[model samples]
Each structure stands twice: as C-alpha cells, then as structure tokens.
Target: MTRYRTTDGKEDMKQKVHWFGAAAIPLAFMNGLFFGGYALRKIRQYWEGGPMD
Candidate 1:
C-alpha cells in the first residue's frame, strides 16, 4: 500500500474533508433518489389498489 503524505498537516486534513464531502454528497443524493423512487412506486401501486408483494 502506498501512503499519501503532505507537508502541511492542516492542508492534508482539509483535503481529506473536501474529498469526503465530494464523494459523500453524491452518494447520499443517489441513495435518497433510489429510496424516493421506490417510495413513489409503492405509493402509486397503493393508489391503483394493487396487492403489494
């Protein structure tokens, strides 16, 4: 494994935080969208009076 090192500790921390936010925001948004879509589908099925399986 390769270790990434930076000369400035604060900068390293900032970079890590930035990277985390960049990755996490899109992941969370996609997850929310997936669940939201499922919820909407279930709602539509209920509206149609269909048996959920």
Candidate 2:
C-alpha cells in the first residue's frame, strides 16, 4: 500500500484554493468559523454563493 504525506496530499486543495473557483472561500470560511469562531458558524455553512463567500 502507498501512503501519502501531508505535503503530498494537499495539492488538490491547494490548487482549488489558489484558483478561487468560487467555492473555495465560502467553504474555507465556513470550516474555519465552525471549527473555532462565532455563532455565525452554522449560518456560514448554509450561506453558499452569499456576499461573504
């Protein structure tokens, strides 16, 4: 079996985030907030294509 390291596995996400394909910022933001931010965390998760995104 082949095992992937952190550096080896982040390329896909790095490219996605770097390209700013419209879904990156929102998903990142929601993830960050939900993980450790404010009450709006839940709200952010559902606010796709929103102004903040």
Using lDDT as the measure, the top candidate is: 1
Indicate the TM-score of model 2: 0.30
Encode model 2's per-residue lDDT on 1-53: one tens digit a residue: 22234655653322222345566779898998777765565568667545463
Best prediction by TM-score: 1
C-alpha lDDT values of all predictions: 0.73, 0.57
Model 1: per-residue lDDT, tens digit, 1-53? 22346777433433334566568879999999999999998998999899666
Which runs in model 2 stand beyond 4 Å of their true positions? 1-20, 37-53
lDDT of 1: 0.73
RMSD of each: 6.2, 14.0
TM-score of every model versus the real structure:
0.56, 0.30
Residue 3, model 1: Cα distance from true site in angstroms: 15
Task: Go through the candidates in order and give the clash count of each.
Answer: 0, 0
